[model samples]
Target: MSILPLLIIVPFTFIILALFIHHVRIKNALSLILGLTNFALAFYILKIVHNAGMLKTQMGSWPAPYGITLVADRFSAFMIFISAIVFLAVTLYSIQSIDKERLKNNYFLFTYGILMGVNGSFIAGDIFNLYVWFEVMLMSSFILISFGGEKAQLEGSIKYLILNLISSFFFVAGIGILYGKMGSLNLADLALKFSRIGDFPSLFEPSLILLLVGFAIKGALFPFFFWLPASYHTPPPAVSALFAGLLTKVGIYSLIRIYTLFLHHYDYFWNPIILWMGILSMVIGVITATSQFDFRKILSFHIISQVGYVIIGLAFYTISGLAAAIFFLGHNMLSKTNAFLVAGWVHRERNTLSLKDLGDMFNKHTLWGILFFISAFSLAGLPPLSGFAGKYLIIKAGIESNQIIVAMVALFVGLFTLFSMTKIWIEVFWKNTKNEKNDSEQRIKSNGLPYRYMITASIILALSIIVMGVWAKPIAEFCETAATDLLNNQKYINFVLG
Candidate 1:
């Protein structure tokens, strides 16, 4: 009955209906319709949450702490709205980008499953339920990653599956320990329990460490992120885009949520470790991205680097800090996913992912070249674009927190990020334009496919980036409000327990 549950239900309903309808076109259309429906529903929910404060529903009319609870505040509603938009855009792009045989194998169904999982993660009220949504996401990603049966795809999927299963083990083990210690799965109740305990700090450390290890793995943070670059480059572009945009973010969101809600007023332990982690992830990710020639691999590394930007904001542990992080999170998804989509288009036109093998984009398709530039420059934190706005806010926050070294590291990384984007721009778009003989890109095996939908999707995303960058003040205000909600621990505690 609640809007929170419908976020998960919308995609799930379509996936089930897909089983009965045998027509591929009809099924794919339903996928779009599902995305659109969820997108609209997400706005309604957002408006309600914005107007009504946080909304909570206990399953089966049950009381808090005992029932499975679903809650949506500004942060959760914002995530659901943005995710639905990204999914819809990707689905539109996939109409032309995806392989036919893969589509026949119910790719849309798997896509919907992922949609349900991600939406579920945004609103789940308990740690265990969050883990359940993760399993749902993992299974769908496994199938999508391994689809088409390519040797590389299978290899990537295996490593991904293995690492994530191990992460799941740690997650469940930690959850078991937390429940054993507190006898509560409800996050609000768990927080209340922590308040009453004398040795809360000691109990919190082991359990939280275990949980963060799993989150770090899921979020692809340094030292635990090797699985991502190995696997992400192997999937179809659409799958890769969706994964790049949404999957790891759930982990990041969990970290933010748990720390703000359950681990309130604890700063002595988490701050330094997170600060160093962000610095390391940013430095390592940018340096690696600069060295890469594979298009998607480059973007994949950037995902790691950009996550560092978000983490840097979280590390600051202030209102402005969290707001900057939230803005960066939204900005990165648009820019990063658009970059992946561009790579897919390049592969479609020239059938290559290697930058050395791919060339003369400016002459062959000036339009796509321009679009790629917008996305690339945006990722590089160029002015009047999403990345610049996000990076600026993050650095500003870091400086305000008096973490001058951290801010300096972030700024340095942004320059290198620009260098990597420039490498792609010159290699893929400008290098071959000089040699007209090599400028002739091979046409698709079939030219019957129209470029309209693909271009339309890119345009929509590009415009969003531009608009968000220019109107960043409004977004920053909203993110600040969400941060306020998270920091106002007593308010959330009272609401949940009531």
Candidate 2:
């Protein structure tokens, strides 16, 4: 009867139904209804959290150590809410964007499957369950990435699949080791048990390292990020938007959860590695972004770079730092999804995503041009946008933690991100094309704003970015509470297992 289990069950139920239903209209209608309902439930969960602080439901009538548990703390609630909103928007946009003949019913099934994985990951109360959810999400994502079965998509998906599978192995191995040592996969039980154990430093450290590395691979951090750019741009824009918005954030959420709840004792060992990785990823990601001629590729690289800022904040391991990271995670998800939506619109109009082949869009598509600019500026951390608010908070926290180098890296990375954005703006919007012959003017003329709904959705998200920036205080307070809950751990355990 608990809603927590429904978050996973409902989407999967629809996925099964969609697989058998061949009618496209029914498929789209059902998918949209399900996505919206799920989003509403996520919002309702947020309301419950606001009133009660945390919500938990045991899978059966059994107690903590004996039964599976689902939890909705402030952090989990925020992530679930964001994932639901993005899933709904993407589902609505997919109605016009997806190719009926190529993907058909399979697209909806995979999409819903991905939602199930994402939502389950947020609420899972045990490490083994978390791994199961992560695999479900990743496998669904692989299918989504190669949905249309294009050559490029197939190639990219292979690379992505290989890397993620490797990461999954590491994750499974780490869980096995942990279970062997602790005899419990429940996060609360593990935390309590680890606290009681005194001289088992070596065993705990290796297990923590293995688990974190697996999360890092999933997160697309530094060395494990090559797969992201290889495959992210190959998918359809709607699929790409969902992947960009939610997938990496899942990895980040897992890393944050494990670090705060189960691996706090190993901060000295992990923090330094995370700090350097953040700096290296920021520099490398921006540089690669600058070199990219394709719009989606640039945005993909920027995703890596922006993630570095979040990692840097969390690596500092202070209350303010963790709070800043959470705020940035929310901001980045909204802004990144908007950016991909813009890319999709541009592709729909021009039939191409290459910056070199696109030109003079700003003068013709003024509304979309403005929306793109807003999203890009937000991603670059420009003032009066949510991105800036997040960057400011993280930088402030870094400085307060006496990590001056990290603060400076964040600032420089922001400027470089701006440079990358400007490059896209000038190439695609400002510059005049010598050959407009290849441009799909006839389609644009006939359709007359083909991606209108998608554009509207993007604008709403962009507005949220601005609003969150202007009213930072309330969001900051929420993030602070979430961070404290993560650090304290008892609230999550009590709510889930009590």
Residue-wise C-alpha lDDT for candidate 2, range 305-385, written one tens digit per residue: 988888998899898999999999999998899889889988887889999888888887888888889889999988898
Give the alpha-carbon lDDT of every model: 0.86, 0.86
Model 1 ranges off by over 4 Å = 198-204, 433-441, 444-447
The residue pairs that clash in candidate 2, if any, are none
Worst 10 residues of 1 by lDDT: 437-446
| TM-score of every model versus the real structure | 0.97, 0.96
The predictions' CA RMSDs to the true structure, in order, are 1.6, 1.7
By how many angstroms RMSD does model 2 differ from the true structure? 1.7
